[model samples]
Target: MNKQDYDIIVMGGGLAGCSSAIQLRSQGQRVLLLEQQRYPVHKLCGEFLSVEVISSFARLGILEAVRKAGAHPITRTYLTTSNGASLESELPGVGLGLSRYQLDLLLFQRAQELGADCLDGTKVNSVSGGLQQGFMVNTSQGNFSSRLVLGCHGKRSTLDLSRPFTGQYNPFVAFKGHYTGIALPGVIELHAFPGGYCGLSQIETGEINLCWIAHEKILNCKNSTLPDPLWQNPVLAARLHSMQCVRKSQHRLSQISFALKGKFDADVCMIGDSAGMITPFCGDGMAMALQSAEMAIPLVTGFLQGNLSERDLKRQYTSIWNREFRTRLQIGRLLHASFINAGIANLGVSLCDTFPALARGFIQATRGRDHGANLATSDI
Candidate 1:
């Protein structure tokens, strides 16, 4: 009705939403980007981009921007067991470490420059769908209609709370913060602990971003309301405890209610953590999110142009996400599951140390360089 306010309305101003908005605007489509928070918002993220993400950034013409914005260049990743046995692997292209506060804002500004009508501090309360008119999105500010709606909201939100997907379970919780005292020698680190694992990397700002995910059982043992002492498991407690200036000490916690799955149709494609998410053990989550957009945008564009049927768009989007992410997430989940048993995790560490080639292969696989049908498949 009334020709709609925008062609596309993207909810959530994170990497996925901003990227999608930018891409769509670059192609001469009018996009409306809504973010619940203003620019420079912080999210609990690994802060380390894989080689595939770096490559995608280059393709999107944002690599130089990232460099100029002081994103750190990471050349390798090091993994250590609870016993301190370590394994290292080199990255094909340098990964960049930039926090969501900086990265998402930069992308949002880029989208604005490309003609996206960005609305910050705008909360999307609900969305109603129709086959003919598509979706009517309700927000705190006002209502907007769009030919398509995209959910880029983070891990869990009111949107998901109201939507009610079947058979969802609260799986695990994640904790992350930024610290300054920890010393990292230009390598990203994954240190294994009980229940789950912790990641450490020196972001471009010289701050170490420490993130962890663990089962609810482990988190319940600490007795304190805070996560610091709870996270002080014998495995990684010493290393993380030594760090100082832990600004933004609050953990971005969320239960893994569901695996990474895009439930919406072409008129409403979900992206990033809003779609299902995998375990962060493999360090490929960011890569998957950005690359998924590259696949979804063309189909979305085709649908908007009336060149592709809505059925075709839904089939194509779901097919592409399943192909690209389903298995990798499964593999990551299996790997993370095995870590529950310290013996298995220690053994994995031993294997990695025994064979540097194994470490290299792990790096390649996580970076999306290991070719397979999931990556090579066409958007049928």
Candidate 2:
């Protein structure tokens, strides 16, 4: 292949893209990672990584580095409803909290170290062609070709506009910010308001990350201040009152769709949120992103190595994706819908409070199985 060509091209430098590039490069495949923004930037993410990701991080050889970067273990979860009813549950396994700014940089550097071609601040304008003829990728930097392409561009992107499975648009907007002074050690909290919910957890830097997802109409009514609805939940109110925003400006993202998306488009495979997005309060998005990248490796590698046909690759990937995530996404959507309505939200919280075992089961259901745990014991 020429210098500009690669065996694989991964668009977006988020968890899925970076991890895919790193793993593919490690397998002796030439990989190019195109990222639109430079690293060390804030993203509108909850910053809470579920225990499920620990295995993927370990497989990628960045587990220790992530911990070294200040990720703190989270074993408890606190949830509150709009009506002030609340409950706490011990997580099935430990989660880690680390800001996207730090986590993205770490993964990008690791991919580069493994010899993957990384183009930060470069945007992918369009992708054309397919597996039969390879792919012609046009980008801000230059044009390139690859035998395969992975779409890890995340929940909302221009790339998605041209895709076929761009389901009904969701009107949700999300905001995130890091703050100091509000501390909830070893715990991640989800506080439900009238129209949305906020998640609070401590990242590796001991700074609390507050991320919320809500309908645009709900935010528009706030008129440039914290929403009055959040104050209805006393726990959420006290946490917000005590914290001071660390950034000059909070990171905001709009038009986030939680609608299920297609997994494959002929030759191109979609990973992470580009594949599907879970409701935010599930606290499993980051884990899902990493796992999607991990899942892509075998199918992509098999296709590249001529061990699998293109049709088989797509079929297998789609099957695996649905088997692993379809139920979780469905449950997350149902949960999000319930939490958004004040009456249902209160009833749901009250039920959880009344039945702690049910709450634990619900958490486990949303998280899916911890592949990391199985991988740790396997000889593979």
Candidate 3:
């Protein structure tokens, strides 16, 4: 019997990769995590983590670390449309406000503490293989072999080589920045404007996370930056009157497709943004990334343990992945599609308020059992 370099190789050490590393190491598996960026780097995200991470990472100690880091506790929501039609609702569960800069670093360190081999500043050029040939991963440093490879490479990566495996239609572009001198009412907020929606929440550092998503038309092609439409909507503008954007924290990503992504792409098991993006306006995409990690590691464990064949492992994982996320992704697309029309958006909220079941269904379907417990709008 020969030994592979690692039992598993996880590409891209964001939420999915790092969380997968932490869990697999916890289960006594040999895991290798390859990440391109150094720790503490900012990534474009709403930065509002679902409280669901509490029960999921309960044994991992990541939750406690988040709380200790001063992650704001949120139990309510405030939403405003492009027309400034505002409404408030109580959250069924608690949420945490912490930037990816903090969250990713914490998870990366936790994986290291648990003895998982993590390679930072290493970029994976490509991944190829199967049960018969085993898995071969080529990185900037060198090539390595593993029994299984999990692609957590985010929304776009070199692995989407050749033409592109994921959807590449008219996609949304997202922008994020940290701002000082702005305060919130300890609730999660989403403000809508033409072509985009912004999420506002306070993080551990006492700064507001001004993250928004807009149509690709808003991207500045020459500089790869998003124009300052942060104040285009009067409601959004009012919020920023006293706040100053943190130049260092500005981050943006273009071509954010809402098209349904596959469970597996290019022979690599895709998770997180690599798998598919959730609704920028309606759901907790961050938590969905963390949840993807939980879903894959267990099945991968079975394959490495020889309890399941490679074929069975992939089949079961796909089945489970579809079961857990399909409905949520579908709901997100519907929400995104409807949000395009302000009239429908306003009416949808009204219907949700008038018919509590619609709101509850939308929340449960998109947020899962973990959140949307008391949501008051959007399904209709």
Candidate 4:
């Protein structure tokens, strides 16, 4: 019944949306941050933030808060194959493991403190119009207008109807759960199996987060044990057979990767997995989600201030994202192809042992660090 407008309207209240809202509020912009779910809701995620992300957290003034909220520091990452061969590498900086439930709530609360209107249980139905002045958002609560809209709604949602373009739909499903008995590596650990890889890490509450991304076909055929036929390699099949006793808390499909385009195009900037997602094998997706908000803030702010146009904002955002993540995404894509290749996987591990620096570089790249870049190696 009432129409309240803000400088910007941010849909999805996860890490990226909250981060963007906080940044905008800090610049004295009026912002409305909406979330379909209430605070402290859990989502299926790896729960590990890489060192690159921790650095951003410190700069954003939330590192201390994250620790005080019970997040645990992880200093290293360990990777093991089904054949039992393993490689371990120290992160160039400290990483942390914390559930999305806690992390998102922390970010949301911070945004509220900074003056963003935080709306929970508000499901956005659709958005219509462009970036010049503002667009009308149709939600369950009615209509609202804002010049810029940000999508941070995670992997799957019905909001794609509001956009003009969508990318190819992937058919993979990601299942995640939290368990208590497993002693995760002091850092994030990845165990590769056929059809997919699983990330295991210890989160703040002393529980281990286990997440697996596999083909939907593999999941559908399994009766008791996960189906082996879907796995392209014998190594992945062997690993799945071994996880019989690991408990599960939640199971869901991570949406196929997609992005918004058209007149609705760059008018709305999508953040987090809503823009694009990376395989979780590297433990950098969530970090990239948060960091992307940081990178987009200045451009968005400038656009709002008339210092930059929508075209410039979109160009800048795309350029920064590509510069920062394109290579890593490409490398991840190459690695995904080998997960099912026994010869290549084995050869890869052998290579890591022969050239430790090269292995470190690969790990760094997986964590979204550019190759040959020098980032601080620390755990604080």
| Tens digit of per-residue lDDT, candidate 2, span 1-380 | 33337889999999989989988988999899999998878888999988788878888989879877868888789989878788888777678889899999999999999999898999999999888888899999989998889999998888887665556666887788888987889899999888888899998888999888887777756433366776777889888888888864378887778777889765679999999988887889988898888888988999889999988998899999999999999999999989988889899889989988878777888886773443221222
Per-model TM-score on C-alpha atoms: 0.90, 0.94, 0.91, 0.86
**Tens-digit lDDT string for candidate 1 (1-380):** 55877889999887788888889998999899999998886777788776567666766667678877887767777776665566777666556678877888888888888889999999999888754577799999989988789889867777877454424767678777788777685578887766777888877678888877777776765532234433434545666568764655445675665465555833467888777776788777777777777888999899989898878988888888887777777777778887655668788878978987876665555445532222110110
User: What TM-score, to 2 decimals, does candidate 4 have?
Assistant: 0.86
lDDT of each: 0.74, 0.85, 0.77, 0.72
List the pairs of residues colliding in candidate 3. none
What's every prediction's RMSD, in angstroms? 4.8, 3.0, 4.0, 4.0
**Poorest 10 consecutive residues of model 2 by lDDT?**
371-380
Q: Which structure among the candidates has the greatest TM-score? A: 2
List candidate 2 segments past 4 Å from native: 1-4, 164-167, 222-225, 371-380
What is the number of residue pairs that collide in model 1? 3
Better of 2 and 4 by TM-score: 2
Per-residue alpha-carbon lDDT of model 3 for 1-380, expressed as tens digits?
35789888999999889988999998998889999998889998888877566565565677678767877777778877766577677666777788889989999999999999999999998877866567889999999998778889887776765525444475677778999987885699887666667888988898999888777665544534434554555677788778787889998776676656676755677878788777876657777888888888788788778898767877888888788888888888888767655677677767776677777677767876665334222210
